[model samples]
Target: MNAKIVDQHVECYVRSLLPEHTGLLKVLEQFAKLHNVPIIHPEIAQYMSVLLEIAKPTRILEIGTAIGYSASVFASHMKRGHIDTIELNAIMAEKARETFEDLNKSVPEVSLSIHLGDAKDVIKTLEGPYDMIFIDAAKGHYQTFFETAYDLLSKNGIIVSDNVLYKGMVATDDYIVKRKITIVKRMRKYLEFITTHPNLETTVLTMGDGLAISYKKGILNE
Candidate 1:
């Protein structure tokens, strides 16, 4: 399952350099692995936190709240920010809510709101001008998510899409299999659109799976 730019040893070495997390995050990470829930890699989460620090986004919208790990990361990094995370699975949503509550005990200033429902439907109801939008949900619907999230993005906003490389399959057909062809094709198409879109300046980092960071063009001069 490790189809990334860095080899396993290098990845491990890099991760070793990161500070240890002894909080609920460590517990969540362990639980997610045991249950096979796809959570962002620790290095990826660290990168996201760095992005949050630089952007200093006050309002963040996360499309997937899978147990609230990334949401918690975002909240902890931002000095002042509110997160609105969506999760389709009720059980996962409940667990994420609990995690947020637990995290709140320490960082009471960070605000996190969980929306339980299909992200597509939830996207329709959101009236947002969020400073940052993090998409880590259904890989197949990334294009739709980006389209819906575009209108909600504030000026100078940033959109971060995780798992864009799809295990390096999107870059080349060598790793492709019959069952995953559809997702690979869709992810490739999504990458093409984001990279070539007239209004977006997108860069795909060959990190965990891959992370696509897109900035709405023309926001800097304004």
Candidate 2:
């Protein structure tokens, strides 16, 4: 889905200014482009790198494991951390395992576990207190994923939701296609809940389709 949330010129300029991806990340980026696999945008990756650096999370829970690109990126920023990632597609899960194996060789300090199953079911089986939670799976089920995983997050942890704006369709009806109407509506509902929830403070950024970063309020302050 080609959704130009940010201006094309500005996005390109921002990407141009960032450093190139090297090693396995470089290969994965190229492979994703060639195979048409949906991975995090380069700009989003860079933004997350900075956030991860600041958060310095010891445990991360990733809802989507697409070829392990984002998980690998998370591993690189971590000094010594564990990432538990879920993948629904069996083929993609195997591919992620291979990528994790390679990542192990490079960053032995970080460990990764790929859980193959529907996130809705897998999330319930997971234990709590993860330092960070990343949601990047099926768009329509984002609210379901977040609500189920909410208690799994640590007190000060943050939840990052990718593609929340959904190619700009969630923002306005003018950009909505008939086929995407349901998804757009669901996305709008999810955004409203997160933004208005008394327990959370959320900010939706317009970059990279749309990224919503949320953090719990009371417990953290307490």
The alpha-carbon RMSD values of the candidates against the true structure, listed in the order shown, are 2.0, 1.7
Model 1: per-residue Cα lDDT over 1-222, one tens digit each? 536666889889989988777788889898899999889988898899889888899899999998999998888887776899999999999999999999998778879999999888898899888989999999989999988878898877899999998878888888777788899899999999999988788899988889999998654442
Q: Indicate the residue-level lDDT of 55 in model 2.
A: 89
TM-score of each: 0.95, 0.97
Q: Write the per-residue lDDT of candidate 2 for residues 23-91, one digit (tens) a residue.
A: 999999998999999999999999999999998999999999989999999999999989999999999
Best by TM-score: 2
Error of 1 at 118 (Å): 1.1
Name the TM-score of candidate 2: 0.97
Clashes of each: 0, 0
Among these predictions, the greatest lDDT belongs to 2
Count steric clashes of candidate 1.
0
Query: Global lDDT of each model?
Result: 0.88, 0.93
Q: lDDT score of model 1?
A: 0.88
